[model samples]
Target: MDNYRPVSFWFDSLDDPVLDLREPPAQVDVAIIGAGFTGLWTAYYLKKKQPRLQIAVFEAETVGFGASGRNGGWCMGTATGIEHMLSVPSLQAEGIRLQQALENTVDEIERVCQAESIDCHFARGGTLNVAGTPEVAKRSQQWVEHLHRLGFKDSEYCWLDQAQSEKRIGLSRNLGAYYTTHCAAIHPGRLVRGLAEVNRALGVQIIEKAPVFNYTRVPDGSLLLSTGRGAVRAEKIIRATEGYTESIQGQQRSMLPLYSMVVATEPLSPEIWQEIGLTRRETFGDGRRVVIYGQRTVDDRLVFGGRAGYYFGSKRRALIPATDKAVKIVEASARELIPALRDPALGETVFSHGWGGLMGVPRHWRPCVTFDERSRIGWAGGYTGEGVGASNLAGRIMCDLVAGEKSDLTTLAWVDDVPRRWEPEPIRWLGVKSIEFFGDRADRREANNQSAGIWGSLFNRFVG
Candidate 1:
């Protein structure tokens, strides 16, 4: 097979052309930096809520060239638990509130697509969290219980016993699994392209190939963003640069970028699909140190992804077909769960595309929306690898902030700037690797205990 190319199964059939706003006007009412989900959605909502507001978005590269285009398109509600927000009770409440608000983001996305006539391959078949080992099953059970305590009575999530899970997911090696009906998969690239079209139809200016160098608070209370070709002066500014936030200088440099990678397989034959039995358009992931996530595409291909390599590097270097050891692990895990997958034909399945991108993760995993009243600068980031839905909610909150609406969105506590210190450069380079190493050890030990059935009682005691 040829080396993995950047083939977007999602955008393959879409006819929407890329937006070219290379030269923006001198000023606008609202200026958004970064043209991913956050930037585009922010512009969309701002126009919806305040139609008269002149909005302009500046993208460093082409739109959706960032994580928004290259992520594992699972648009589930909140994935990160409240553990990250327990430190601040107020923020914790807001996190829960935002989580509730976003419970239907997938539905909202579908609604928008249908209304705007955007042809994104949208499916609502839910997702499965497969447990490779007993330890993973134990954790899945605990997570389900946690969701119960959080008052999730929707019956969307159910625990499957070994036999049931094996029959349902075609993964006999799995100890058990937790299934949720709320999650859905989409072609992320196509979704972004459609949203860009919708935004343009609404007269929002999207400038691509226009990298913003810096922004300053003008004496007249408007902020001026200096770009490579030209500058945009706006009444308010929103920073939606998720992983690329670190590239910004000055006070907003506290954010750190985390890289993640994904790989997609060549379309499988009907016989292979019959053997796999994963035909129900569901996404699956096993709870491991280097978590593996995979979903069946509409065209019967399996797209899988996991954590990036040990070092902090660019996507071009870190996430390629040759360097995709993580994808191999996922492919192996797939075979392990489905004994039929051990066939040489299945093992030889070529990956069509492999790519990676960065997402911003704050020391504390809570999402942040801050307002600088003096300069009218607003910012949002720190999605911690779960920004698909959070970014949509963030765009709404950002619009509310711009409109000066004193709703719960503005009341959400913004993360105070922590000391801008990362693990020393060399150490930082080794950070992900270290986590992978230790996290694997912990998971393996837990799996061993669970397989022996001794850990269940212990975990039950802890839960009780």
Candidate 2:
């Protein structure tokens, strides 16, 4: 296999090399700086809105090669820091409205996939936020009640008791779960690669292996995107690099890149699946403060992952081995959650693939979909691991912003809410490390039937 294939199970499964190595064009009306979901979706909507506009997407690697291609494949309806937005009276209404729009975005993705004939293995199985302990169960119920208080219908968010949740998913100690019909499981590789092809058909030029090392406002007022191979000048530049944003010159602290890892099991036998449950293929989560996510593949494989630690200095991974320490941690979590995974009959072989990648989190933990008229630069990202479906919405809003249209998309809270720059150097490193430490300790305390205590409180304040 090539180097990119080892990035994730989804990437490894693709039949094509997905290498679009053509050089970028000299000049264009619009220049996008990544071939991931954000850039591709932005291009898709732009072409749909204005077919005559010239657009080109430049990527550091192949399509979906970053977090878009290597994420846990969760097309969730909720964006990070949304609950925080709901806490304010002024922003609450807009937050609810955003949630509704995200729900529609889920269907929109399926619609686009069907219309474009992209078989990304998209499945609307929803999600089960499982509770492993009585304390967590109580907390989970309180959360559901809070949602109801905020006018969320049961169809949108509801609670399932221990017996009900266990019936749906046979987790080791599942006390209950909060189910939401706003998330889906998908093959990240297929979705991204397909979107790139759709953009091609729409006459959008995509150039891979062309990294935008820097950009500046030229004397002529056009932005100059400089790359190793060449440079391009455009009237508008879209900075769509999510987790890898810092790689460019003069953008070191724009967004923080945090690493997450995953391991997927081989297609299991019917008997093993019976012991495992998740027949509907609903995505699973135990609400660990440390953060864990999983899904059952169309091929009967168990794809599982969780927090893979923050690398010092926000360094990102290219290709990870099956034996990586972070991969082992995720594998252990999978077995701990699902006893079927630890069966003696299954023997030593269980997980088939393991990989890791980065997700961008802003200093304020909010997403940004905005355009600056003066600079003529529009960008969207800071999803904090919610890029799958959120990127679709980002694209639509970006289209409006880039085209100078004053539509609903351009008026959302995030349209002008670019995150603040990350703290510099050792402070940034220490803060990230401390958060991970507290998160893990909090989960451990909860497992022991104690409150998350100071550790949990600290984590909530920092991460939120």
lDDT of each: 0.69, 0.88
On the 0 to 100 scale, the lDDT of residue 309 in model 1 is 52
Highest-scoring model, TM-score: 2
- Residues 1-464 of candidate 2: C-alpha lDDT, one tens digit per residue: 24676778897788756576676788999999999999999999999999999999998877888899888888998888788777777888999888888889999999999999999899998999999977789988998998899999998899998889888998898988999989989988899998998999999999988888998988877899898669898989999999899989988899999888889988988877888788888998898888899998999998998974677788776777889988898898888888888887855447889988888888888899888888888778999887899999999999988888898777778888867899998999999989999999999999989988999999988987
Kindly report which residue stretches of model 2 are placed more than 4 angstroms away from their true locations once superposed.
346-349
**For model 1, the run of ten residues with the poorest summed lDDT:** 1-10
Local error of candidate 2 at residue 335 (angstroms):
0.7
**RMSD (Å) per prediction:** 4.7, 1.4
Pairs of residues clashing in candidate 1: none
Instruction: Give the alpha carbon lDDT tens digit for every residue of 1-464 in model 1.
Output: 11112434343334444448557989899889998888888899889988888998888777777778777888876545344443245555655565566667677877888998876567777777888776678778987876666666647768878777776676665787888877777788877888888998898989987878789987877788998768678888888887777556653335557666776778877777776666567777776655667778888787777764533442233233425566566555655655555568655666566656676766454577765666788777677677776677777777777787778666654433333445545665565455555555565676566342433344322211
